[model samples]
Target: MVGDDFAKLFRTFEHTAFRLEVRDRYDASYENESLRKFLAGEPDDLPWIQDWLTMISAATQRGLRFSRVRVVSLPLTDYSRFGVWCSQFTNGAGEDIRYLPRPEATAAGLPNHDYWLFDSCILVRMHFDDGDGFLGAEIIEEPAVIVEHNYWRDAAWHHARRREDFATEQRIERY
Candidate 1:
């Protein structure tokens, strides 16, 4: 249930891969340069990011669904702003990326933890340190747990707004 092992699930899912991102920031090494550029008020582009974008593009082209709902706080963090910026590319590549303000997500009774639900079956819970460094992934196979995660996914998706719409709103609020 480590990062590499968890990633293999992406290639094996038959239909859908849904992610519920509850963290305001992820300390993934690959994104550091992009984050730097974002903070410097420069282009958000990072060459290595193309690898993930390509993977997403390929998966969607093969007819699989890719979606994620990020639960963010009202006053956006620098990382959250960067996420909105990156969503443009990810969403354009056919992944349905959405945002849910923390208050709304709380009203929907969503869990604070982050996880990925694959084909409404396997639940991969993400573990991270206080510094936002990813620790590993924990795979859950119980039907009851899967059902609960699935319910959370549905609730989050219902309350989320597409990236395009949310980005505009964030720009207006600038919070």
Candidate 2:
């Protein structure tokens, strides 16, 4: 599942979904304007993630749950700060977003790969370039692989800090 087939999982996952984000920076075409504003220290006139918010809102209303843990460095990068800003909108719309310091995650032996595990069954392993640009994604449904990723998701979730708390701890509100 590389294109539409891959996207269908978002609409079809039965109950839950978890994401493990290990990159300190992500470059996506959709976030270009927001990233620019974040880098230039300017305010965004409108939310860039309206679509994601709407999707999460609808999914949660339907009794579906979504969560994610982002492993980040101690001194947050500009992109990490921008991620904190974006998490605000997503969390408000019913996504559980958390931050895990990279050192702690490394200490725990969590894999550095990024993926989305749906309903503890299917996985979409994301591929990205060295520059943090997304290249493609592959869907995996092997039971053994799913089990391994489930363990990873649970480990990350157990050690992560909620969006607001982590932001406060990092004093991101000053921005």
Per lDDT, the best of the predicted structures is 1
What CA root-mean-square deviation does each model show from the true structure?
Answer: 2.4, 1.6
For residues 22-135, could you state the per-residue lDDT of candidate 2 as single tens digits?
999888777888888878888874466887789999999999999999999979988898898778878989999999999999988899899999988888999999989888
lDDT of 1 by residue, 1-175 (tens): 7856877998899999999999999988888888887888876556867987898999999999999999999899998998898888888888999999999999999998999999999899999999999888899888898999999999999999989899998882222
Supply candidate 2's per-residue lDDT for 119: 89
Report how far residue 108 has shifted in candidate 2, in Å: 1.2
Off by over 4 Å in 2: 45-47
User: What is the TM-score of candidate 1?
Assistant: 0.94
